[model samples]
Target: MLGGISIWQLLIVLGIIILIFGTKKLRNVGGDLGGAVKGFKKAMNEDEKGNDKSTDDPQARVSHDDEGTTYDVKAERKAEEQDERK
Candidate 1:
């Protein structure tokens, strides 16, 4: 009785799916899906709150401390070295 499929037909399909995948695997998949949805909702709520705060304070700037950070830099090769390699 759902979109041209009978309740019995739905039950049969459900049974076949359960038989193919088993119950424990299905349960784990459902749990993972639920957790992902919950995390997504939490992130969305936090983003909305952040947007509100940013709107309220236009002059706010995000700053980071770079006290002891070192970047990997390669030494520059001279034109003579480049010509030798070529």
Candidate 2:
């Protein structure tokens, strides 16, 4: 028994869900859900592999503005915080 509901009650609830959604719609929904999970796993694996390569490259740490100005972003942020105190 789950939440005080017996196996028979659970079966009734499952039957209602299938009847409301229909078998084909339910199958499509299941497929879409599975695909999303697979894609998310693939992206996470790629990020882990990519981060190691990027961190070792100095140029990858610099961010460029639209005006073509480049700055050491971490240092610039610290400078801004110090300025706010004065």
Candidate 3:
């Protein structure tokens, strides 16, 4: 009997699993389970950081379009219009 469940019950459940999936397949299952655990840990870490808004320390700066560009929006539009006319 299992320490909790009866030994027979545990054996039956294990047998069912082995029948449904061979041992080799079950071995690969561990890798998938480990990956899921790792992903969950990463998501939790991200959430913890997401809740802290006071931290403005960015590891890298991602600039949007024209973020660092010197071109003025109005001048660019006017230049495009002039080019179209030509």
Better of 1 and 3 by lDDT: 3
What lDDT does model 3 reach? 0.85
Lowest-lDDT window of 10 residues in candidate 1? 71-80
Which stretches of model 2 miss by more than 4 angstroms?
56-59, 63-86
Cα lDDT tens digits, model 2, 1-86, are 46799999999998999999999999999999999999999999988998889877788877666676667999999999999998
Off by over 4 Å in 1: 55-86
Better of 1 and 2 by lDDT: 2
Write model 3 residue lDDT over 1-86, tens digit each, in one string: 34679878888999999999999999899889999999999999987897685456463355466767676899989999999999
RMSD of each: 7.0, 9.2, 8.3
Q: Rate the local accuracy (lDDT) of all candidates.
A: 0.84, 0.90, 0.85
**How does candidate 2 score on lDDT?**
0.90
Off by over 4 Å in 3: 1-5, 54-86
What tens digits encode model 1's per-residue C-alpha lDDT throughout 1-86? 46899989999999999999999999999999999999999999998888878846645754456757664344335655778899
Candidate 1 — what's its lDDT? 0.84
Tell me how far candidate 2 lies from the true structure as C-alpha RMSD in angstroms.
9.2
TM-score for all models, in order of appearance: 0.63, 0.61, 0.49
The alpha-carbon lDDT assigned to residue 48 of candidate 3 equals 88
